[model samples]
Target: MAAEQAPSSNDVRTWERIDFHAHLLPDFYQRALTETGEAGPDGMSAAPGWNVQDALSMMDRTGIRFAVLSLSSPGVHFGDDAAARRLARRINEFGAALVTEQPDRFAMLATLPLPDVDGAVAELEYALDVLHLDGVAIETNARGLYPGDDAMRPVFEALEARSALLFLHPTSPPNHGSVSFGRPRPILEFPLETTRAVIDLVLAGTLRRSPRVRVLVPHGGGALAVLADRVATLAPAQMDLGDVDVIAELGALYYDVAGMPVPRQLPALLQLASKDRLLYGSDWPFTPIPIIEAMAAAIGSTDLLTDADREHIGWRNAVTLLPRLAALAH
Candidate 1:
């Protein structure tokens, strides 16, 4: 196969995109999920299937120059600490192999066994130092504990120490049974879950303390653009924020335009987050390929963004955050 030619300035559809929110559901990881009775996670009927060829084809069709793959929601931890540790190693190794095989087309974020701080820290070390994966991807909440919880401090500290790029994907909130109303959790609860995690991180001063860890929030920050002011005004009165500016903290983070971010979500996000921090994301395999194509088209044609802004979102901003992409390109 011939390498794709670089797009000319006028070629809107052929913009080389770097997808920051793509997922990989390997058979081994799926088997782990199934054994734990999470075959249908967060109310979905079954986990989406994935393979390298199909992913490569989709990337070629959609003009994606590179993708950062991750393990999606319900993560590796399923109650037992030892099982979670083993599963995390398996997942990271799988991703590292993929990246090694196709360094130009793919990069991977390592998975960690969260809620078990010791295991998570150890895995983080091995993943970064040994496997040499790009960074870490963590669920919004791990076994009912949000990222800001005191127990997760060590994990955050380790990530900060390494100056890691952290990708935040929302999982089913701990109280899904009562709030989800029996619907698939991704439809309604996922966005709210992302919002909840961000608020918790800000309120608990986690973001303030972990200044070096570059964080990417998925789904255009999950209703954060609309709700940020409300949280800013109301949270200080209720919680001891200790001089943390809610809006500032929210604005400082990076965000990906995955899962229908244009028209409403992108504009809302722009009001809060800087344009330079925005990146493209396909949320593929889980989101069907047809929808991914349509969303890419929408991003290309949307009048909301200038050509420069579109180029930035497509890949420039991502290269800034993940310098490995730039290094690989050379």
Candidate 2:
């Protein structure tokens, strides 16, 4: 792989943003979706066609310097733990190889075979230590089990030990009837599910127990900004929170402005967390390039966030989270 030339001062006008929530659809992952015969498992009408070249073109056009890749919805395991394990390893190897080649353009959050506790743990160990991935991307709920479930404690413990970066991606909610009331899932259910999972993690004391784990949540933390007060009020009484400050903990975690970052979403997120807590994301492949470009334009036009705020969310905060990006920032 050829080294990307350091951007000229004028080139900064292009994609200087660091995308924390981009995805990679490995051929095997696409095969899984095809084999299942599911039409847009993420609630879209059908799966979007994706390839490395397409992603690169979109990134270059939109001013994204580096995109941290993760597998999107329906994650690694599709009701088969063993198959998921193999797929996870293959995906990790593929992503690691890409990072090795680009080093500047891409980094990856390893996909683990979750809801398969032992396999997840083993994969996490190898992906982080051996493959040298930046971190792991996890579903809000894994195979009908939320990340906060006591069953996944060992995995959380391992993440805490490594102080790993955990990027939480929302999944299709199980039993999606009412939420699906002829409405698109990403329009309603996706953000709502992310809210539910984060609530579980907070109320279940998972965040409290795993203090060292730096979490990165997408879609500006979904519904968290809207529901912050409710969870803040109820969590302490319902859970054994000890001395932990619920609001502070939530504020400390990272959120990415991947979807429609303006209007109500960004403002609400700002109220919940400091500006530094926010990161930029494009949601490429799944999100059309036009929408991503629109998001960038919106951010540029917005009066709510200052120049410093834009800089932080664009890539500064992300570089702070993953230092290797700093070297590539030029």
Candidate 3:
């Protein structure tokens, strides 16, 4: 039997196709033909509407050069410490191997066992030192503990020490009383939860303490724009340690225009963040890739960013923080 023939590379320019946010689940998690009674209307766990090969084919058609893979929500964050730890290892190994097999077409954001400091640290070491993942993708909350909870300090510290990129994706809190009025999460819950998480992190001083850890928030930073002023007004002038504006410190974070129309939101984001801190990410699998491309195109057409700035947000910032991707970006 002859060896399998590899697909030929296309002529699309590298810069034309950098999708920062894409998700893929392991085959073990596929619920398409799942016998478990957990299948939702859409299909699988979170997004049953799409799959791995479907995403890659879409990328090819759209001229998307690469996609940074992350596990969809509730990612090892809800399980007990032991289960979470094992799941993190499984996801990272699966993701790293995918990148290894298709070096030029894929990269990864490792998942970690949150709210479990020791497990988080262990997973980070394994992911960075051994598997060589690009970064870690953490949901806004772990069970009921937000990323900024005191228990999560060590996780942030480790990520900061490693200069890791922590992509913050939103997930609904475990308890919901009034919000879930026969609606799917993405319509409103996702953004609402992100706002809550952002506020918690800012008030908790996570941003100030972890200066080296660069975070990228999704869904146009979900309620961040509208709530910035309110947070500043209510924040105390001084913490026991120092005086800092909670809102101002938010500028230190990076945000992606995933699933948002760039023309409508990029200008607002520019007012709140440095051009270099803004990135292009497509919440693929959940949303269509074409919409993401349109957002990027709209942003590119705005003339709001210079060539260097575009390059930085579109590719370089990710590469700088994700040392594993340094050569790939070049």
Candidate with the greatest TM-score versus the true structure: 1
What RMSD, rounded to one decimal, does every model reach?
3.3, 4.6, 6.2
Q: What lDDT tens digits, residue by residue, belong to model 1 across residues 1-330?
A: 999988655453577799999999998888988999999999999999888998998888877889999999999999999999999999899899999899989999999998888999999999999999999999998998888998999999999999999999999988799999999999989999999999989998899999999999998999899999999999989888789899999999999999898677888898899999999999988898788877877888788888899889988899899987777442
TM-scores of all predicted structures: 0.95, 0.93, 0.84
Weakest ten-residue segment in model 1 by summed lDDT: 7-16
In candidate 3, what are the lDDT values of residues 132-207, reduced to their tens digit?
8988888888777788899888888888888888888887666643666656766778888887898788888898
Determine which window of 10 residues in candidate 2 has minimal summed lDDT. Answer: 7-16
> How does model 2 score by TM-score?
0.93
Candidates 1 and 2 compared: the better one by lDDT is 1
TM accuracy, model 3: 0.84
Candidate 1 or 2, higher TM-score? 1
Candidate number that wins on lDDT, 1 or 3: 1
| True lDDT of residue 20, candidate 2 | 92
